[model samples]
Target: MQALLQEAASRLHAIEDRLTVRTQIAAAVAAMSIALVSTLAAGAAIISYRHTAALIESSVAGIASSTSARLDRFMATRRQEMKLFTELEPMQRLWQGDPTELRSALEALQRNFDFTWIGFADLNGNVVASTGGLLQGKSVAARPWFKQGLENVVVGDVHEALLLASLLTQRANNEPYRFVDIALPVRDTSGKVIGVLGGHLDWTWASNLIADVQANDGNTDTRLSILSKGGMVLVGPKRETIRYGGDELADMLKVRDGTFRETVDGQQMLTAFHVGNGYRDYQGLNWIVTAS
Candidate 1:
């Protein structure tokens, strides 16, 4: 019995030592595991951040490219219509000093095209005829389109159409009407400039184009902008951070087309841009389209 009791006591001591050794081993293993987990978590976070950035850059680039292509197509169609109008027999007759015929031609153009105003101007910048009779005889000599028409087919900058707004018999809104003038020089058979033919495109059409692009995007946080060559904001969200002709546009002027990171309104943004390369057979106004 004494021998058995001594043997039992020895076994207990051995078991206790094993348990103590296991506790030490467990504590060491737990400490190592915590350190390993912490290191792995940090590495994962870095990878995730980089992946998200790459994704955003690629996505924005795709959107910008696609939107630019659509805009080019839209502008191409308008340019074709403009060219066709200039080649019409009635337009030639108007150039030959037929005011009544010119008015009829202008009326037909207004019915067929989406222009806010279609008009013909003499070399002296006097309105020979216009779709809206109110603008007849108005002097457009100081207008940008008139000056540009003397050189080449050009699209003018966006501006509030004060005169047109005043003449509107029915207005949908009190906000001033905005328009972009597209003009082409009318030349005779000898290639000498005879007159200027132009039309005003509603700025709302451009705004709607941008809005449609944004609506089709899955990202709710994304924003889009259309900027002039001089870095003026032509189209942007109705936010203070993005305003017409705002300074935020300065960052876009340096690059012709590419993806970049910029801080706008104190928030970091990834932006992609494409420069306008006029539609087929027409010189495109160098506009920048961006998606962020």
Candidate 2:
């Protein structure tokens, strides 16, 4: 009877050991499964985050590209028009010594275009013909437009009007008039350079153009800016200087056209930029257009 009882006890101990081993194996498999699921979830989250970031960058870049193209077209069209103006009948009458006809033509241009003033200066830099005859009989010999227009077609940078602004009605806010200069040499039928044709475009046209662009896009959150080659802010939400040398923004400028993430003037933003690729024969001004 004692031997039978000992054998039963040994069998029961063996059964208990097998059950413990199986339980541990089952627990190990469950832990491994949970770990694998967690890793997959983490990987998926990372991929989603990267994709969202890429999409935002691409969208901003697209807006910048579109704005650049529009500006190029605007500039190219104006340049082409200036070229055509040289061939107008009234302009051709210059060789006939008829400054009145040329003045009429320029006046007609002002009616159709946003010209603050347009004039044809003689070789002596005396304004012989002008829009509305405002500056006619005046000597602009010392003006940069008169000097540069003698050689070639020149697109001057924006500047405060010196004498032209005072000749006009004052703005309600008494703001100073700003102008962009465009000039080219005028030649007679003999191909001999006779004089220089120059025009001052009101800066308001540009501001209006940008406003229309932003309104059409319907994206109020996105801000666009135009910068000179040296990074001076030419047009934007606010006229503020952006330091260009030795910063990450400088590195991005070297790329000429791309997207970047950076903090500008204490605001962190994702920005897209496209450098001016001047339209056909226009030889762009190398302005940097940015959308953020």
Question: In order, what lDDT does every prediction score?
Answer: 0.78, 0.81
- State each model's C-alpha RMSD to the native: 4.0, 2.7
RMSD of 2: 2.7
lDDT of 2 by residue, 19-109 (tens): 9999999999999999999999999999999999888888888888888888778777777787788876655765347777778878887
TM-score, cand. 1 vs. native: 0.76
- Model 1: which ten-residue window has the lowest total lDDT? 239-248
Kindly report which residue stretches of model 1 are placed more than 4 angstroms away from their true locations once superposed.
Answer: 1-15, 30-42, 88-94, 219-221, 237-251, 257-277, 280-292
Among these predicted structures, which one has the highest TM-score?
2
Q: Residues 1-292, candidate 1, lDDT per residue (tens digit)?
A: 9999999999999999999999999999999999999999999999999998888888888888777777767777776787678876555656757777787787887788778898888899988888867578998888888888878877776788966787865556666678878888887767788888888888878889988989889865668888777666778854223332445455445455788777778998787888777677756677788888
For residue 87, give model 2's deviation from the true position in Å: 1.6
